[model samples]
Target chain A: MPLFFDLLGVFFFAVSGSLLAARRGFDIVGSFLLAGMTGFGGGIVRDLILGVVPTAFVNPFYFIPPAIATLLVYFVAPGVQRLVRPLLIFDAAGLALFCTSGTIKALEAGMNPFSATLLGVTSAVGGGLIRDVIANKTPSIFDPHDIYAVPAMMGSGLIAMLWMLGIRGWTWELGVTAVVFALRILSLKLDWRVPKAVGPWHHDTQLR
Target chain B: MPLFFDLLGVFFFAVSGSLLAARRGFDIVGSFLLAGMTGFGGGIVRDLILGVVPTAFVNPFYFIPPAIATLLVYFVAPGVQRLVRPLLIFDAAGLALFCTSGTIKALEAGMNPFSATLLGVTSAVGGGLIRDVIANKTPSIFDPHDIYAVPAMMGSGLIAMLWMLGIRGWTWELGVTAVVFALRILSLKLDWRVPKAVGPWHHDTQLR
Candidate 1:
């Protein structure tokens, strides 16, 4: 069941990545590569940090699904755009699932809870960060409009807390996942944002 | 003197990256970002892997050099192309220096010789890898024509062996750097290639 969710999450993230690449007018090869990275890049970083070879590199299936998703997007982009809302929902679900799974993996690897939470947040948001960097845009995490990282942190933290309470099962995981998704959706709908303070020290000075 | 060399390296790499981005018809912002990544991306990755915050984020000088280099390239791309060879020579020097520095850092972090060597090689070539990925090209390391990683490994291995022999100071370091630069230049001049067996697996099946 977990594997099934993982594959689904991979597919949606690949779709989102391919769409972004297409917006940049990338060729088919670029689209496929970007999609693959979006789906697995964060996990690869996490694994490398843990001193383990990336799971995406070890499992051929992880590669194949993203490739297929990219191809599908290439052939069906016109139709896919019409289903943007549905795809966004799927992406949100995938984000929640990946965050939960990442936290669990870090914990199982004997990392401290704080480190595991950080890993989980990174795993959930790392792909989008790469995509934004490649596309030459300010990452969404840095943008005031998006409540991206907070939800992932909440979800991962909830999982860690629940696991510590001896409630280690799908029910607990799913509940945490649902909470993250709900918070993200609600934030989007309510336009929740971190308060901006325009103090004397904070000016529009370009550092680079 | 070391800081001067490092800045010189940043300038040439930024020029190379910006020129590549211009050739691809990227906008000015894209060119700048590419140049910045090419200049400092490897060091950032090396730091992150060693469980340290990236120095690039903390140092304004690191950001400034790449920004200036990118702006120069943006305004003078046609003239810059004529200096590609010199820029590459500087880049080679940078690669050697970074490889030695990375190995030392890994050793300081108490990593084993193998891990240090691996970190060294990655640090030397990592920026280029990220550059190629963003530019939508297969990484030059994976290219049959490129002898990129081998020189880095040779330089890193030499440094590690010297360190093991209780040799410290600029003498051994400079010697290893010269060897790496010479080997890279020789490989380019002689078109040195690792031999590949002509077999069924080597055949190109796809008709591009």
Candidate 2:
């Protein structure tokens, strides 16, 4: 069941990646590669840091799912764009699943709570960061208005705390995921933003 | 002296990355991030794989060089583009240096010859791969016409073999670097490319 959610999350993220590539007018190969990276890059970085071989590289299923999702996005993008909001909701669901899973995996690998939570945030946000960087945009995480990384950090920290307190159950994971998803959605709806001060005179023209 | 060369290489690569970002009209923050990644991403990956903390993140000097380089490019891209070929030569020199340095670092960290060679190749070419991905271009190494990765592999392998044979000197390192640099230059001059296979089916206007 956990693996099922994992695959679902990977598929959705792949779709999101493909959509972004398409929006940027990337070719088919670019679309597939971008989607593949979005689905696997974060996990690869986390695994490498932990000295574990990346699961996506070894598992044929993991590879195939991203490719399939990329193809689906390529063919269905015209129709899919009409329902962008719903697709974003799915993306949020995938983000929640991935953040929770990453926290669990890091803990299982014996990382400390802080590092585990950091890994979870990285897992949730890394792909989008890559995508934005590739597309030459400032990453949404660094944007004041985006609540992306914060939600992941909060949920993962919550999960680590609960796990340390011996609260181990599907219900617990689901609760944490729900809190993250809700926080993210609420932030988006309420236009929540990080505080910022005005730039110095010379830098003011470039501040975004 | 070695630190000087490292800083020079970081500056050149960071400028290249910034120019690429500017050509695509990225904002100042985007330009800085891309430049930083191009300058430091490979070394960070190599260190992490060898179970060492990323030196670029720890050292303020490493961060500052790239930032300065990005500022230079941000104000001088048009002039920089005219020197693309010369800049590439500098980049190749840096690649050779990093390949040797990375292999030695891996060996010092107790990695075997094969792992050391792999790390060296990755350390040399990894930044460029990340740069290409972010710039939305096919990775130059993956292009059959580009001899980028092959040269790195040869340089790394030679260093590993020579070290195993107890041949440790500036002479061996310089020789290997020259060989890699010469091969890259020759490949460019000769328009050398890997052979391509024929199409599975020849089609003309999709005759039905």
Candidate 3:
């Protein structure tokens, strides 16, 4: 069922979060927090925008994967580095599932198409942003060499397009997810990058 | 009157965010984004956890002050460093207002006191966290020299306690706010810091 796929996506993202935490040298609290944020942060952001209690708090099922991931990272992180290939693949899959579903949810909540697409991208990438920020690094999306956000935007845009075309179904969702997954995986393997912006100003940055 | 105070808080927070952005060398977009985040991010986080559309989007009033603050930062940032003394005052006032109101909102939404207090603290500090994260710095609250989160926590805890005592009024709220504001300002002036944990592990570095 869809719930199963959702949980699977959460599981992979949690592993990625925890693994990243281990690599960064954060203690156990940091690992657990990162896993939760990676698995649920995007959805929580989306839900908050839409005026809903985050599902992560409402359903205990969402906690399981992240908890397991933290334990895995603590126990076997050294060996996990060799599994980068699998990790990247799972990350892509999670991106696909999350981006598509995130767009759908936003649209269903009556958001405008453009904002919905942006929110979808947020739902896909926001968790990683939180993780990177907490680790005191520049967000990967803002990195000139990073291709992470582009494919997520592309997939989210496609979902918005599908909705505009008056077509909505699991079949369409599955097809879009596959395309996003492929694109992400391909981009990773080929070391593709978004054309960098040469902003005319220094990076020193902001306000309320 | 409360709305006026709310806008005043937003304005001050926006200025703080913009000042920080300028110090970090972020461009105009970063200034605007940080302003918005610092002014509205905490409340949005609180609303999301409480299941409400953020008031910022519901009413145009919330957006005005941050926009103005961004403009001010763009126009007169160089001279504003001299304003740091006053800036801390406004920042403390904003923190007091936000912490008290955030706690009240959570209690009204029926969350348990512990969670409500945590949420209130979050609403008080979340914006600065966003700003620091984007600027690629460790959040000040996590720093041993920081007194920010602790004071917010204390204020939030007091609000929760007042609810438990069946004493909820504007008078009580103002008293709590005054106490928190004084504590923050005093800590800043005195260079007070939270004692840090001597953790058993080294800080290695990555999760992915």
Candidate 4:
């Protein structure tokens, strides 16, 4: 079950990356590379911070899904790009799952709850952050209007709380996932956005 | 002596990152954060790939130089920016040192010579890559015009070859460093630029 969800997360992220690359009209190799980066980037960062080699390089299973997704997207670009509804569902599930799993791994790495929870959000969002940066744009998450990291943080925080309370079980994990998944769904449906900072300080910041 | 060069590398990288952030008009905190990222990003990636925790978080010495650099940049923006001539020399030295050290570390981690050499280039270039991406620009090294990563790879590959030949010592490391440093200096002096990939695929890339 865990592996199933992990693969699902990889698949969704890879597809998103493929879609972005296609929108930018990148070549086949670029699309494949972007898909692989998106699928594995967050996990790689999470593992790195936890002081482990990236699982994607070590395990073929972690790499194959992205390769497959990239091939599929390359072959059927328009069709895959248009599958927005299913993609949204899968992406929301992925966001939640990665946050919980990333937090758990950080906790295992001996990180404190606060740091673990933050790392959980980093795990969930870091892939796309990297993807956008490489694609030559400001990261969407840093825009302050994106709710992506917020949902991940909320869920990861809850997981941390549960672990601190010694309530360790699959039940809490599932509940946390559901909460983030629901929050993501709602945020999209409601068109929610975080308020942007204003003023000259935000405009042209001076060191002194 | 290695530690001394290592700190010098971090300080140079941190100053460069802060300069970039200041150019982008980012806030004080953003400057500090970017400085930290540039100083530690490559080592973190190198350590993670080597299956070790980030030395920056483990050792304060690895981090303090960046903090100091940020503060220094913050206070003396125009003065520091004007010091680019000396900074370039320090940066070149850092690049060579990092590539040699990074490759040696990868070799120590049991990676093959080819992989170790590649990781060496990554360690030398990765920090600047992250800094540029966060500053919302394409990486200068990726521009092909920049001889940055090329020289690093050359130095690192030499380090790996020296290791293979069982010629391990400071003399060889110094020789490798001289090779990269001289290459960088010559590239700048000769106005060398790698020929751009000139297909339709490369057209829309901004700042090309």
Model 1 chain B is weakest, by summed lDDT over 10 consecutive residues, at B199-208
Provide the global lDDT of candidate 1 against the true structure.
0.71
Estimated TM-score for each candidate: 0.55, 0.56, 0.58, 0.59
lDDT of 3: 0.75
DockQ of 2: 0.07
For model 4, name the residue pairs that clash: none
Native contacts retained by candidate 4:
0.16
Candidate 1: regions farther than 4 A off? A79-87, A197-208, B1-78, B81-126, B132-208
Candidate 2 or 4, higher lDDT? 4
> Who wins the lDDT comparison?
3
**TM-score of the second chain of model 3 compared to its true counterpart:** 0.85
Superposed model 4: Cα runs more than 4 Å off: A1-40, A48-101, A111-121, A134-136, A141-208, B1-8, B28-37, B44-69, B79-93, B110-115, B133-138, B142-146, B161-167, B170-179, B182-186, B189-208
- Report the lDDT of model 4 for residue A40: 86
Which pairs clash inside model 1?
none
Where is model 2 chain A poorest over a 10-residue stretch in terms of lDDT? A195-204
Over the full model, what C-alpha lDDT does candidate 4 score relative to the true structure?
Answer: 0.74
lDDT of 4 by residue, B3-73 (tens): 77667777878877766665655545456556767777788788877877766645546657776876776
The digit string of per-residue lDDT tens for model 3 on B73-133 reads 7886567557556545666777877888888888888877876776787778777667667
- Write down the TM-score for model 3: 0.58
Q: Which regions of candidate 2 are displaced past 4 Å?
A: A1-125, A130-208, B1-8, B80-87, B170-175, B193-208
Note each model's CA RMSD in angstroms: 10.6, 8.5, 7.9, 7.5
State in Å the error of residue B69, model 4.
4.3
Residue B77 of candidate 2: its Cα lDDT? 40
